[model samples]
Target: MQHLSVARPARAILLGSAGLLLSGCSLFQSSAPQAPLPASATLPDATISYTLTGQGSMPVVFQSDLGDGKDAWDSVLPLAEQQYRVLAYDRPGYGASRKTATPRDPCTIAAQQHAMLAQAGVKPPYVLVGHGMGGLYQYVYARLYPQEVAGLVLLDPTHPDHWRRMQSDAPTSAMAIKARRKLMFTSIETVEFDAQAQCLQHIDLKTPLRMPTMLLVRDKFGIEELGSVETLVRSQEKDWQRMTGAPAIERITGAGHYIQKDNPVIVNEAIKMVVKKK
Candidate 1:
């Protein structure tokens, strides 16, 4: 039972009064281009807070890490919207979204997210962009509703069998990871992250992904804390491609767990690739 979270950094998007002004710009948050977004683009839901841009036939959905919200993608959204409609949201207890007593399992979270977008009138056959645990959530969403997802871009997503692999491959590193997740993670995180790691085991890692998919991993995956696991992690990550039907698992050099914020150009290009898929 290991739900290894990707631990994403931020989401990028610029708000313009006209809903969107799509254009390519450099991949950066501070230096990323900006546009004035209208107030209506933001929709505060009864359970979550989400921002939806444009009404294009196709939709690009952005799901953030467990600790972050839609604002995390603010820097990248501007560029993405230049070509497609996009949606970003705050899962319960992350941003303005309130926490609930509901059990925070992958299935429950996926269903809730689906309901949120459905209520917003956002159609599916979507290109999903997810980071960290958000990556896990989006993956589950695609599994539950295969017809709804057109493609997937997972940014260092939690490999469903993270803990098992760690324990089997490196026991000491697994303990350290457990302690780090419990201690270093902020208190406001609504999801019981450590506990959920076990639940991820329920998912079948070999389940074939019907849609085009890519797994983007950070170059120095475990250097920051557990350097020893680097070798083991690289080996384990290979399964993500096999499971998702991705051509290859790509690595983002000079990037951390939050590949979107560290090297957004690659992330954007991946999204573009999915969008362009027939």
Candidate 2:
């Protein structure tokens, strides 16, 4: 998914004059904002923008990749709505949500999600469907509130160990560190990226997820575009499979990073697997 470029100016004003670096497809264009949900919820620093559709016993909550908002899941919402209650929301600074200078750490982000869901009256035993960077937040949420999350579907998620593995090259390591510091002040996504990396270092992998989990890996990553780093990313995907202990692992062919957009059927299949678990 691409980034939201036009929102940069407005975000700069809210965050600081340092320039709020924004990325991802336009939140509106990606999902084509439908009629507003019947209600909204106010969090500590920002009022989240979300849509709740369908009605069922267990809710399917969707979280988008970095630089994306809830709408990124637009393609799969209709299918999911046929059988489940669906919840998709914009994070603090994405889409219609208010901007904040929050620390953007995984724990803080996960906590806010818990509070937002509670305040919105969205009940628990949730089946979390997270894409890209959003997977990190979902992982933390499950860890912090294990009783609430029933299952998980990770769609081409960023492996927690990606940074540790990718930094083997000295040049890449230095460049990444420098870029992260620069983006920290200008981009909310960047801040979260750094925080997730830090959080991963302390994670106790010995504690098994032990829930119904599915890990989806894209079969084709444009190696030409990524250069030599493509090899490292592919290696990390294998590592993620082993680390996550996901019972089902699917390799989606003919799809790029945004597998949901490229192939909704596969994504939906993954979601259904978890949702059907007893």
Instruction: Give the number of the best model, judged by TM-score.
Output: 2
Error of 1 at 192 (Å): 3.3
Q: Candidate 1's residue-wise lDDT over 1-278, tens digit each?
A: 11223333433221100000112223454334435332222223337767777445778899877667787686678777766788888777777777666667777778788888787778888898888777778898898888899999987776666656666776776665566556665554524464445445666667779888878876643333345466655765687778888877787655566676666667778887877773
State TM-scores per candidate: 0.79, 0.79
Whole-model Cα lDDT of every candidate shown, in order: 0.66, 0.66
**Which ranges of candidate 1 are over 4 A from the true structure?**
1-46, 181-190, 195-202, 222-227
Tens digits of per-residue lDDT, candidate 2, 1-278, equal: 11111111111111100111121221213233344374567877667888888757878888876667787887777677766788999888888887777777777777888988899788898998888778867877788888999988887777676555555632454354556557544476666656766655556555668688888765554323244455665666666566666764566655556667666766777777777773
- Per-residue error for 125 in candidate 2, Å, reads 0.3
